[model samples]
Target: MGEYKPPFTITNKILSYISSISEKIGRITAISNLETKPHLRRNNRIKSIHSSLKIEANSLTLGQVRDVINGKSVLGEQKEIQEVKNAYIAYEHLEEIDPYNIQHLKQFHGIMTRYLVEESGEFRSGEEGVFNGSQCIFMAPPARFVPQLMDELFSWMKESKDDVHPLILSSVFHYEFVFIHPFSDGNGRMARLWHTAILSKWKPIFEYIPIESQIEKFQDEYYRSISECHIAGESTIFIEFMLSQIDKILDDISVQINEKNEYLPEAVQKLLEVMEYDIPYTSNELMERLGLKAKEGFRRNYLHPAMEMKLIQMTIPDKPNSRNQRYLRC
Candidate 1:
């Protein structure tokens, strides 16, 4: 492990993805209202937790994950439900964790695997492997080598932090982390979390980008990228795969933001225009703001459609007809 650089090449295609992703991140973060938009941030964070857990065969649906987070009783396995809970708690502390510190990573893992794994915070004391059905796809380094390998990897990351682009830096760390397979049960989840954490440190908007959703959509390609890279003895392929995913996720967010009005009903679009993302408006208040005198028409053509499309969510979902109910743009 002497002077180890964790073997990865940056290609021109990777450069293109980085440029595009960086620009999108900058544009998104530059929006003044983003910091105050809880709905937007919450939606993305829930998707990330749900999708990452789903990739680990957690068997909980995205809606169920949201329900669990909201303290609603959901019918699911205890382990999967606990995974969602754990992930939510861990993600809430993203701003506090130091990505370059190995102890912080292990501490985060402890939080992530609490009540689930036998050795929550500790690296595997035995051999580990990546399995696909009954076949073994990759064998991790021996347990004795885990500490030194991880120490070297983290040292490299800290030393190179100022010199490398985070898109590449995080991607390399992800590939190397998986190859190390340090944890007994939560290796994949940790890899995804740390990858997001690293990017978020670079640009806070990344904490809300739902990169896990993109990874879950291309789970096969993710594993394929890892296997190909392992065979080639470098992370170049996986880095490219992840950069492409980030580029695509940015494009997806742009579509939902810019082109949603194209498919929305005219009434819904008009209603949304009258509302601010960070403000909650009661139906009567919204109607007054819209200069609509008829409650029935507004509810039928505007409110109902917006609610159906989830363009707006009721502040009191359980008691939608509550007098105190308010609607906020989602």
Candidate 2:
């Protein structure tokens, strides 16, 4: 095989983000005791699949994604619904995946793109380009080079596992995988799922972090980072961005855990767990975090009750959904 040294210059900023992410990962590992509860684990896996597919423009809402995963019928385009199903199937087999195995990578792509693409598990025979509407943002290397390039990349990853930090390695792999654009379809989803696979191998807590949920929240930035990395011919920016997302997700989980431990009334406790005491969060963010699907029901039961209980306060007292609407704990 060729000598595979991925292109990326590590800087202090990258180091700083990696250090912060590592600390957060350590904290999460300690808090989780390396054991994620079954219900929470399932919820996170659903969120990961939903958010990743949503980033790819799947029309299914998180609620509908949950329904589909639960074996309930969801009203959406058949392809989108199938995307959710395929993602769940791939994630269910995460335990059996060898993250550094190239064959496993193709297997995952097959599972993730089953019935959704003509060339499901196979790398593209034709060339590929990433398009944003009429604009072509990225073009992959020639089709003939894919197998060799992917093999070299995986070989580099396997060799670098001990020398490089998992956070940096996973982020680098994610950026490079997208840059390669090996598959005819499902490359974006594969990049995401594979990065999570890499991280879960390093720390089991990552299997439950739902970093894809955070990525969906920052979708524009996510693409921008990739575009910038492609232009720069290095993965540094993308690595930093992914590590930041991971750190934020870890912070949110930590906040969720600590807030749940607080002594509060049953009605407002869930609200408090979702809210930040200092930083304001949008109602949608809070509701999504709490898994509340109905805005009216959420307001009447959770939001209004929390407000009435003097436990949470609105950023704009007069305007609920305008003029910078957000909520924070009292």
In TM-score terms, which candidate is top? 1
lDDT of 2 by residue, 1-330 (tens): 547788888889888887887887676666554242454566678889989998888888877888888799888899999999999999988878889999899988999999889999998999998754456678889999998889889989989999998888998899888888999999989998999989889877777779999999998888888889888989988988887888788888775554344455564766764553354778788889888889898888888888886778888998876857988776
TM-score of 2: 0.79
Model 1 lDDT, residue 80, Cα = 94
Please give the TM-score that candidate 1 achieves against the real structure.
0.83
TM-score of each: 0.83, 0.79
> Where does candidate 2 have its weakest 10-residue lDDT segment?
31-40
Candidate 1, 160: how far from true, in Å?
Answer: 0.3
What candidate 2 gets wrong by more than 4 Å, as runs, is 33-36, 259-330
Q: Report the lDDT tens digits of candidate 1 across residue range 1-330.
A: 548788888899999999998888766555433465456678788999999998888898877898899899999899999999999999999988789999999999999999999989999999999754455669999999999999999999999999999999999999999999999989999999999999989987788889999999998889989999989999999999999999999877765444456577778867876775546789999999789999999999999989998889999999988999999888
Give the per-residue Cα lDDT of candidate 2 at 312. 83
The regions of model 1 sitting more than 4 angstroms off are 133-135, 258-294, 297-301, 304-330
CA RMSD of all predictions: 5.5, 7.3
Best by lDDT: 1
